[model samples]
Every structure is written in C-alpha cells, then in structure tokens.
Target: MQKIIVGVLVATFSVNVLAWGQLGHRVTGAIAQQHLTAQAQAVVTALLPNEDLAEASTYPDEMRSSPEEFWQKEAGPFHYVTVPEGQTYAQVGAPEQGDGISALKMFTATMKDSKASQADKQLALRFIVHIIGDLHQPLHAGNGTDRGGNDVKVNFFWQDSNLHRVWDSELLGQRELSYTEWTARLNRKISQQDISAWSDIDPQVWVSESVKIRDEIYPQEEKISWDYLYNHLPQVQERLKMGGIRIATYLNALFK
Candidate 1:
C-alpha cells in the first residue's frame, strides 16, 4: 500500500525546471574544480577531454535548446525535484522516472560504470556537475505548488521578474562578477570535517536544505531591491559555496 502511494506520487513528477542561469552554474563549477583531488581532476580531464569542469557545467542546460527527441525526453526530469512547501522529497516520494535526486544517483552510477561509453560518461559527468549546482539553488527543489516559484511573479528594481528567475540569475547577476571572479570571491578553506560531512550527503538531503531556503525566500512584498539583495546575498553565496564544495565531493568520490 505504501509502495503504491509512492509510485502514484512519483508518476506525476515534472522535469527540466529552471535552474541557476549560466553564470551561476559556472561559478559553482569553478569552485568545485578548484577543490578536486588530483586523481579526480585527471579522470574529469579524460572524461571531458576538451572542456574543464567549470566549462562543462552548463552543458545539460545548453542542451535544452536542442531539438533532439532523445534529449527532450531523457534529460528533462533530472533538473529538479518538487518537494512542495512543508514536505520533504522523501515524504512526498520521488518520481520513478527520476527527479534531481534520482538523476544524481543514476548519473553518478553511469560515471562509475566501466562498461559505459566515453561519450555517455562524459554526458553523465556534465549532468552530474550541473545537477549538483542546481540542487543548491533553493528554487530548484520546487514546492508542489507555484511551479518552483516560476509562477510567483514579482518586481526586481521595479522590473518584472519571477522568484525563480531572481535566484537563477538576477540575484546572482547583481554582483556582476565573472565566473572566475565569483569563484575567487567565494573561495574559502572548507574545514576538513566540513568537507567530509558535505561530500557524501544524499541528493534528498540537498532537496531538504533547498526547500527550507525556498520557504524562507518568499518576499514580504512584490518589489525587491538592494535591501533584499543586501540581506540574501550572503545566503546566495553560501549556497554557491556549498554547491561548489559538494560538487567537488561528488567528483572526488567518483574518481577516487
């Protein structure tokens, strides 16, 4: 009975929800690349061949513009998991086709698969890098309502924007930092214990953390400006930092 309920909830799962815009993904990617182990860096280099981890971070998102049926179907649902307000990913049950949580698990498995083709592994690595960054952007773990804040329209500096878009690029974009600069600004010496703790955390756990942020981020009014930015900017940077650190953790584990 419990299994049937979970299956039913999973069936209605949505996919390819919006994520951190290009610059944000790159920021996290750069951070992760900086922290990778020598062994992991070697494997990532071999897998990507021409692209560095930071450069490859946006591939999954870039592919969204492709018209291929395979990409349209297979790559869609992995971008996010809708946890809904007041509920957790596990409590709501993940879709069988997979959300970010399931996709992260699957993509990591593909990365470790000796039988997987180089192209396939490369694709997996890109998706893995993108998804970890996505999972950190509070909005990526959408609530069952509001389409992950996409439907929640608001004004940024008197310009129209949605809540998700604010987090995706607008908020992060406010800093006007290049990806490299963002990486440099956010670079911190993660304590050994913090690295150990963050590296192996489950995707479901990421969703839970994101959901908490999502809930708290709802603006008191429709207009957001520097005051809002001033307050939440640190929170945003922290997410980026965690995204980078955790991403390195995932890569290090895969290549180790």
Candidate 2:
C-alpha cells in the first residue's frame, strides 16, 4: 500500500513540472532584450554571439531532458522555491539541495567572477535569464503543498489539466500568439512608471510576489475555462512584463 500510494502521488504531480512553457519564457526574454542597457546588451552579445535572450531563455528547460547527472538530478530544484502557507521564504529558507533563491545567488556570483571561464559564465547567464522568467510564474514559488497545484486536477478548456499547467502555459497558450507577438503587445503596456516599480533585482521580492499571486489563483472548481482565463490573464501578462523588466535591471546592474 505504501508503494502504491507513493506511485500514485508521483504520477499525480509529475506532469508539466516546467514553470512557463517555451513560448512564455521566450516572450519574457525578448522583452528583456528590448529593455537591456547598452552595456548589458553589448556584454550579452559578446557572451551569446549565436543566440538571443529569447533562445537562451529556454535553454535550461530544454536541457531538462538531458541524460547528464546535473540536469537529471541536481538542476531540478533551481527552477522554483517552496514557501508554505503563512510562511515567508526567510522563515523557511532553502532546502538542503537548495532552491531558486540559492541558484540565483550562485549564478549571479559566477557572472561577476572575473576568473570564471567563458563557458561557465555563459551557462550562468543562460540560467539567470531562464530562472528570472521562472520566478515570475506564480506557480514556480510553490506553496509547499500540492506540488504547486499539479495535484489539483482540472479541465482547462474542457481538456484535462491542472492548476499548475493552467498558470504555466495554458493561460498564455490559449491566445495562440507567438512569443514575438506577445512581446510586442505586452511591451506597449509597460509605462515608465511600470518600469521603475518593477526594476527591483531581488529574487526574494520576486518570490514573495509570486507567492502572493499563487495564493489567490487556485480555482474554486475543477472545470476551468473562459471565465478563469478572463480573470487571470492580466496577472499573467503583468508577471511576464515584470520578469522581462527585472531581468534587464538585474543584468544592467551586474554588468555595470
């Protein structure tokens, strides 16, 4: 019975473990690229001569399928931070294996270390871009229950899904827009004031914002459809925009 129960729980929560789908991450990256300071842009161009931020934004998730030990076992926790109900991230701290907050610190140090190898800096840069996008997805800052809502089954647009997937991809996917199209539309909505307000580079602040959003987004019913989309789409857009802005702000400060 114990084995059976464990298997069932694993199956229930394993689907769609990624935070933002490919398109969403790309959208955040593109937006960030547009916002980058000239120095940051020059450094990014030197580091990623072949790929743009949009392409780099998806590298960590794309590598999740690698047979290597780092991707297979070690890198999983870097994608999210767990904050249980009524508890702050400061109160809970990172687990033994570490989490998104620790990963950000590690990679940020790598980016700044003058002696770090180019390849190592490149890897860190890729993760920084990707992880910033991940932290923006409310579900990535899990509530320490339900595997970030993966266990809460639902029907998204009449198709079987879960609360995590709904926030991770389905909400953004429903619009059928390419990442560039999404970036174009979202960029227009960002005002100077919005940029100023969302420029904070602290990962903890991002996690806190995500946890607050995560708390309010759980569905009241298992049948999620247009109403859910209509209600939460703005929040989704806001997060993506903020993610992009912060990524730029962070890199600018780092490269400065």
Q: Which ten residues in a row have the lowest lDDT in candidate 1?
A: 7-16
Candidate 1 residue-wise lDDT, 179-238, digit = tens: 888888878645667666676557777878888888999999999999989988888888
Q: What would the per-residue lDDT of candidate 2 be over residues 157-181, giving only the tens digit for each residue? A: 9899989888888899999999999
Best by TM-score: 2
Q: TM-score each candidate.
A: 0.90, 0.94
Instruction: Give the residue spans of candidate 2 off by over 4 A.
Output: 1-15
Q: Note the clash tally of each candidate.
A: 3, 0
For model 1, name the residue pairs that clash: 10-95, 84-143, 84-144
Every candidate's CA RMSD? 3.4, 3.1
Q: What is the lDDT of candidate 2?
A: 0.88
Model 1 accuracy (lDDT, Cα): 0.81
